[model samples]
Target: MATVILLRHGRTEANASGTLAGRTAGVHLDDLGRTQATRAGDRLAVVPLAELVSSPLERCKETARVVAARQARHDSVRPRVHSDKGLTECDYGEWQGRKLRELARSALWKTVQTNPSAATFPGGESLPQMQARAVDAVRRRDAAVGSAHGSDAVWLAVSHGDVIKSVIADALGMHLDLFQRIQVDPASISVIRYTDARPYVLATNSHEGDLSWLAPKHRRKRTRSRADQDAPVGGGAGPGTPA
Candidate 1:
């Protein structure tokens, strides 16, 4: 069996400033965010990190590097940082760089609430579309990383709140709406494991140094979607999906 560690990036200046930052430029980690990264890195540093992959977005990339560097894994395990467009935050389109609450108070919120799939983020991507892109990206990543490894692979993917939630939802056989229920704090660690193709949640939405459960009660009512997603919404440099 292979172990996979899913970690969310540290908080960023954009998060503190209340900006959408969808693929925006110059949105880097703030002081608190850096501390969050360092602490998260120290906590996971003990684990044997086989591979470290991050969202191409700066926040996640920076966080991944910090964690990989701190992990003392280079000796026992080879750790390198790689970027994946698939692992990026949701593209809020025209909504990028705007306060989510402000958007919720605006006219756009109605469209999003009513027809989430049809509602475009003005210039960004939809929720379902984001779910598709993130799911596909992770699947491809697991395949690539699993194939490239000679021994058992333990992979870590650092990503945005929403992206990670989507991945977790897919792993748990849930929907995008359930994403709202699964909370991913900044610098959190959510674990998903696979004995074969079937995946079970070992943990979800864990903050730095968290040993508690993020809840594992699998809902039996919802139907699991098997649709495959392969493309990215707005591609790269989008602001992370802040919960």
Candidate 2:
């Protein structure tokens, strides 16, 4: 299957102020956030993205546009940014637009930190609900990209910190309750490749690296073997090398 690059949106004024900007309109990337997004775009410029998907929220859309623009400069095909509400931030409901320091004082805050599966926002959705939709959206889009562009295809999804963490947790086969343990910093990159057997987490919470290695290589046409569906034993040779 195709590899999906999960990108958390750049920082915003709300982020710096420690506020939950959940589904809030007009919340955009701050100055540092724009710089962070630009750096991320520079890193991904070498990759030939098959598709670019983003949360409908403004912050994510802004980040996605930067990435798509970078791809346009190098690749003949200009990657189109597609919006997916499923990839949006968790509905914080009454909690939206509130300061994190205050929210942390709530009794439910403990539940959200330790037992997210059972914690539901006062007027919004549960963590489990958020994970369900996010994982579903990524898996569905991954399948479509693999079918359309082949197993070597690579794509991207720009979303919120919590939402991306949920998807990463699911890909790692970890329970949603443990998702908080996964840190998804602003504009950081995480990668997952879904196979028939299981999902392979290639990288996570990465802020810098040479991702040119991920660019699709030109090779002879051949059928995929069972090895392609499974991880090599004894930590076999890495990408672009003979196994």
TM-score of each: 0.77, 0.96
Query: Where is model 1 more than 4 Å wrong at Cα?
Result: 73-78, 110-119, 150-152, 208-243
Top lDDT prediction, candidate number: 2
lDDT of 2 at 47: 85
Among all windows of ten consecutive residues in candidate 1, which has the lowest summed lDDT?
221-230
Alpha-carbon error at 88 in model 1, in Å?
1.3
For model 1, how does the per-residue alpha-carbon lDDT over 20-112 read when each residue is reduced to its tens digit? 677886778889889988888877766656578898888888898888778655345547898888888888877888887787898768766
